[model samples]
Target: MSKQAATLEADPQLHEVFWIMAHEPALGDNLARIRVSKGLTQEDLEERSGVSVSTIRKLEQNDRKSARVSTLRRLAQALDVRTSDLFQPSPEPVSPLDESVHTDLFALRRTLKPVRGLSGIHMPDFDGEVTYESVRTSFLAANALYREDDYRAVVQTIPTLLLEAMTLVAEAGSPDSDRAARTLLSQTFQFSAQALIQLQQYDLAYQAITEGIANAELADDPLLGAWHVFNECWLFLREGRLEDSRRAALTTAETIEPRFSTGNPAEFATWGWLLLWASAAAVRNNQGDQAEDMLALAEAGAHRIQGQELEAPPFWAARGASTFAGFSPELIQIKAVEYAVVQGNTARALEIQDTIHLSGKLSSSTRHRHMLDVASAHASEHNTAESWAILRDLRTRVPHWLRYQSFARRVVDQLIEDRSRALRADQAEIATFLGIES
Candidate 1:
């Protein structure tokens, strides 16, 4: 039996603790084992990886459960392993009791990829008549929920939306109706994909995007397909497949490169959005020059769409005049701040943050994400009070959304670790909310 198993057997009270720890990334053990097998000391690995010796020690000793994905990438390159290899795979058939596995996620998974048998794939049953208008309305409502940061409602709404869209496709009578059904179905899948991505369910999100792309193809909508590919790039980034992310974004962006002079707002916005994703992947992968080039291209796209909020083509929903998809000047600035933070230039990050006034031009989700980066920048500069203030404000504004942000948790963890005195009430509250033991 494993040492963990033996230890759990020896002490019942330790069971819960061990169970929780088991779900965390097994980076420490993986690092130690890989380093030993390669016949390298910690110092040797540090020299090769350029990760600090102290950071390596903390990781290997299980004192740290997380590190920047780029740090893991460096170590993986040095060890000749995939970046994913440095973390343990999540246990299969995840426990229903696992806090991360919401019932709605399971519902979504079943709706997206139902079990198949010898006969064929089983389709979900819908009692109500599924009309094109009904599906469209539901899709818009779900998108609104997503924009409002009502994720739980979004998750609960998707299964029915998926079923309705699927039913509409199966029952579509005419050629035009069939195409319309497929278009809406593709969009529904995109919404599902985005929701899953927000919940950090990469594998499920990929499945959703793949299905969406297939539907987009059936509808002969390349722009819609490009949008799906954009989500895939995001999934790649979230999974730490930085090179894959960059390549996918760049390739798709080029395929749909808009003509600035003649292109509609949607085309420019979609293209710009893809370029931003590419830039993000490049920046995170340590290709600063490439990242800048991509960012500049994206900025040009944003300029082309200036003073306009263009809903990217195959519009998912009407989110009002102020909302849009893909690229905006504000989003570009946000990316600049994110890149500055990634480069460890905290001062530059804050300076960029100082210039932007919060405008309705960006969605609440986008604004909250930017705030997290600002908070992280403050934390990195050892400005804990400002960091705490940001966290507190975010928590107040988007409590449910704030809880799921791993970056926020990391920032809070750092604050707790670096504090010279006992945890302040606000710090303790944030830590508890994030499930971090203070």
Candidate 2:
């Protein structure tokens, strides 16, 4: 081994630091480097950014891992850089070990991204006969499973569904049958991509969405292609490609923008959904005016839809009904609360949360995300008890889903750090669940 390697091996902490730096730039390190490069002292930064000197010291000393988005935005403004610049790290490549660990999804990976050779593509080997009706039914069942937050079941169901749809496409005899088969196949890919995203398998999710978009185009369905683009924007947001997310969403929304007097409700809902995600991306990127504009446009679309749950093509009744739970005035309100939280207006977030009642209209995942924002808002106000209550309830209700949410982990970490005394039993349990050192 090299001398540097020997030094790192001698100090375990140094080894870990080296590993982290190799994968992603440490946020604390980025903050310190940027501050110094600007010739700003800790006190100077504290005064300019309105961040406390103690907090600045801790961040520079690597005692903290992250700050809230609003805090990052303020610091970035002081530094004259984008908020994303502070969190900059080279893109993390998906590890092959991830596939080995998720062995159950191997078939799915094969189905979504088959091997291509000079001779021809290596298609899934299933020889079973499949009809369009059967494929549609399977797609609906899998979509419902996703909506119910049964991700394990959805993952298990997707590979077979994909194979069956592919079989139908391969064996199709008529143009109408071929179109039907490809349409269902595209929808299946969409559902598969959504499940993969929830499982945090982003690389596979990208493949699935890309395949879906291609199939949609082949089937001559621009609306279906638009839906795929919408989900792609979502994937971009989750990956911290905020500018890509905003641009894609805005461009697609403009392309599909509906006329209030004559547009179909489906058009209105799809347009609204894209705007909502654009708003989300903008707010997280600290573009307050752009965020507000996107939100207003979405709210107008929701108003045009007039509480009607627009049906999705192929089989589902409502557009994004299974995943996003459809775009509605209430859904718009949920997003408003999310924006408020990102802006550090916890009071307004909670106020809006209290007024909006989703009942059973939204999916569990959507509802849970909103609840996370509520918990975050409460925590920011030093209402630890209320925050813990919300988090505990969500953990009890959807433990599997909660485990994958980095946002939930962040909130739990903040709660643990803010407490002066030893963790209570419930606090310790949650901390353990979120993998936070308490």
Candidate 3:
């Protein structure tokens, strides 16, 4: 307790009330002290533990008296210390789900077993009559839907496209036509994997990706085959198999490197993109050296594009590029920022951040991530006020985005902990939205 918080007891003995208040450590101090010593900014903890920043702050400041056991548990997990240590470790034992509750976004385990032998009614034939041109148009439409991040639309459209492609394969009377049909089928499966991955259905995604790879090889389309490599890398990353992810990405890069000298926009961006994914995967897995090597390799490949987003059909999209600027320098720096943050090099990340021009250079999801990293950097530097300011800006610009992002929630939690009035109302709303008591 601080000097002003003291309370005198009536006719109290020497070992009574006054000494108790004076000697006992505040819960807030313990939480704050340990948090700082461990080099964790509140934002990092929020992302790791899903605890709010406000609760952590208040516990440190003594602005609040009590918190739930769950909050302490989360803080403990993020800090890599025992819950018992937080108390008096100098006040309360830390660690759980007090601040917020989230659906496990990357959980691979299925909840309920599937009902055995359940079958749906057969639907009407897709397009009634199938043709090569019709199937090709549908495939392109599915690709467009994927680009738009409309996973549901892609899911809805693929059945018709897949049915048509299968029809084409069956009717292909010549070896050449048969190969063409298989190639189209491969592309369809690749897209199915992409859509399912985004939807967080990993098992089904695995099946689709496997089938896609098989079809690609038979069709003899190296570009689509390389795409399968990219998809494989992506899947492993999400599965938390960092080494496997890195290997897949590296192997993909090696397999496709022979094609890089062509400067064909399709191959160039795809290669650069795979390398970037490798770098990102390495960063998360503590393979900093590998991440650096991957980014350097990616930068070299990005250079091959020469700042032009070339759309050579069936390789690069005519309407959309993989990234906002088409595998350009801005994209490279943004990825570098991600790596730097993971390395705990906030200063380097910030320096890189300043160099990049973000205007019109990012998609909504990508831009939100960039700002979240910026907020984390400031928080790590112990510049709480400035960090909160950045977070507030993020909230104002993308009000609903934070609610879905674990990082954003951490920043919101911190602002609330600091007792920032500007953040309280928002906090109440977010807490309610997350189904946690404010």
Candidate 4:
């Protein structure tokens, strides 16, 4: 077993490091072991975790080596173990394998190569390879789920594939392979970041966007850079940094020059989306002139690519808008939030909250955004019970994968205070919901 695995096995507090080092699918092995130790089957994991039977089977075989963190966590819960338990090393045998076959089996296991290339590009120069088969299989599962439009599954698979790809690149160490893997990882980050944003994990998505910006710059890919900027702006907006978000979005929108050619419709669409979102942020910031100008530019840009199809030739061709109602929902959400805050229309804000897609694999930053909205809206209504309820719910979810450093906790704390301010004699329910003594 690797030092990481051993360390994790020995120290539960440091298990997260093991997850980072194990290259994604290691969670599967850990989950399988825990389940079997409990005398459970793949079907049992599926039934308990809400993961598909096929997924459970693949995980058991180590075929789906890159299952999502959330999926693994659920399985861990079902198996009555901490998610950290998945990072522990394989347990040692109580007794050595019977005399004659043990040595041969050990030799065979040691010599057998994993399905992926042992290239140093993917992972560090470690004891063994992370197996290309592992990464590829995981990628396929993710792509399959994406095609099926299963947003939850797609979000879960992205990070796993990214981790697997990183391991492969570290191991291979080929410049060309590294570049290719980086490109793949960049795509994975884009998907994951957006999914995280949708899931209301703003902080985690923000971190992803930061890394994504650096990667895009390294790759010298303008479109990728623009995408990262858009996500970064989205995060800023969610954080109520309206001015900063608008500034970022405006920058992306204005830079659509030589690089925003017909070859990359996605890039152009991103620019247009940024303009639209920026306008909304500007409106929130009370920059009326800026908002109007941006909105006009947004409409023009959207029209420019309305009917065209993306063609990646010597020069990229314009493609029509993405089918996701790309920028409309974001604009609506920002406007609604602004209206709620300004008019103190708590009911309106709460109603609008249902429209934003959130939960499961969302970046921590994005989750914070939704949580803030819930807290703020309820507080505005003087509904201490409701606000405290949301805060308590956040407390439950925060410990699962709250991996980012942001003001999320501060916002929750503020909400708690807001609820407490309005407490009545019989408001022990609110206190209990806030996890505070009555």
Local error of candidate 2 at residue 330 (angstroms): 1.8
Off by over 4 Å in 2: 1-26, 58-63, 93-101, 316-319, 323-325
- Regions more than 4 Å wrong, model 1: 1-52, 69-101, 313-323
lDDT of each: 0.73, 0.73, 0.59, 0.50
TM-scores for all candidates: the values are 0.83, 0.88, 0.63, 0.42
TM-score of 3: 0.63
Write one digit per residue (lDDT tens) for candidate 2, span 8-97: 111100000011111233677888899999999999998998989988787677665456777777787889886667765335423222
Off by over 4 Å in 4: 1-137, 143-159, 171-175, 258-264, 311-438
Residue-pair clashes per candidate: 0, 1, 17, 40
lDDT of 3 by residue, 175-196 (tens): 8988888887777777666655
Q: Candidate 4 residues 200-293, lDDT tens each? A: 4455566667766666666567666776676676555544455677788787767864253452456556676677667666544445466667
Model 3 regions lying over 4 Å from their true place: 1-127, 143-150, 259-263, 315-321, 359-365, 378-422, 426-438
Q: Which residue pairs does candidate 1 place in steric collision?
A: none
Which candidate, 3 or 4, would have the higher TM-score against the true structure? Answer: 3
Ranking by TM-score: 2, 1, 3, 4
Model 2: weakest 10-residue lDDT segment is 9-18
Write down the TM-score for model 1. 0.83
